[model samples]
Target: MAKEETVLQGMIDRLIEIGRCYGMEMNVEKTKLMKISRQPTPATIKIDQKQLENVKCFKYFGSLLTDDGRCSCEIKSRMAMAKAAFSKKKNLFTSKLDLNLRKKLVKCYISSIALYGAEIRTLRAVDQKHSESFEMWCWRRMEKISWTDYVRNEEVLFRVSEQRNILHEIRKWKANWIGRVLRRNCLLKEVIEGKIEGRV
Candidate 1:
């Protein structure tokens, strides 16, 4: 059994209004309507607002809406949509660290580690003091990272360096779209939650 799309929209609107009356506003800029039920599915309804973190409050009410009816799959499927909506409402921003930049950074870092070779211990020792070299080189358009990790010589001696090219590549792709939206939403949520207060 399922509810009609129009009816669902109406219910959502009413809930939004109620929330506003309580001094909490719905993010109208990110609101959207969609049909998720069969054309003639019964009177059942499902409402979810867990991902609407940008809104001060996300309230829903309906006899047909139930908690047990929502499955994990449904929640996971809509997570990206919710993130995107939050991004829109909050106008979140992210740095444009393109793929090329990431690739160069990883490649150079890995190469430095490789130079230390099979005698990983010695390589790790040299890395302790000269790690800044990589960042400096990168700062000069050579690709680098400004890391502030302090550890004893013994710890660095056992440090193993491995190639993470594929992982970095995947990150680049995600950052351009889904990753960017999710990160922005998370940052916006933090700002709204009193954890971090300032203009996003």
Candidate 2:
């Protein structure tokens, strides 16, 4: 492990040198280090005698990534963002438009927000339950139904003429992504198939 850290530090040094040749300097204060592992240990990586900040979680390409490699936090973040987006367009969803059109809008707009990066998510039972609940919540809110209304989830689906398809949609995306990766000859395929050496 110490040897690997030394190699990483050497590589960072080379990168810094190359960036300097291009007149680009790395912002040590803005840079963060996150060690992704089942059991992450503290990693100290320094640049120019300054240490980078370590984070338990950070957003990368708009998706939350954590040290534990779990997607629950990302899922919750997506759900909250989706709910806020729904609230912003509440009028359109609850408008007197055709029910089918409203449902389409929800699927096109809200689901896209909630399911962003879901294809790569590893969901547990609790996560799946949360996703289903979020789906039902969207429908209920669109129908203007309150929790006190005691409306069953099925009733909400019935009113919307939709079924619980969030999980199915996620599975479909995973399948498509896997198929595409498998068809290509790339490092990602090797990583996915565990062909890379020294992988944790």
Please, what is the whole-model Cα lDDT of each candidate in the order they appear?
Answer: 0.39, 0.90
Candidate 2 Cα RMSD after full superposition onto the native fold (Å): 5.7
Residue 14 alpha-carbon offset, candidate 2, angstroms: 1.1
- Model 1's TM-score against the true structure: 0.20
Which sections of candidate 2 miss by over 4 Å? Answer: 1-3, 186-200
In Å, residue 84's CA in model 2 sits off its true spot by: 0.7
Which ten-residue region of model 2 has the weakest summed lDDT?
1-10
User: 8-74 in candidate 2: lDDT tens per residue?
Assistant: 7788888899999999999998988888889988788899999878899989899999989899999
* True-vs-predicted CA distance for residue 3, candidate 2, Å: 11
Clashing pairs in 1: 2-42, 138-143, 138-144
TM-score of each: 0.20, 0.87
- Local distance difference test, candidate 1: 0.39
Best by lDDT: 2
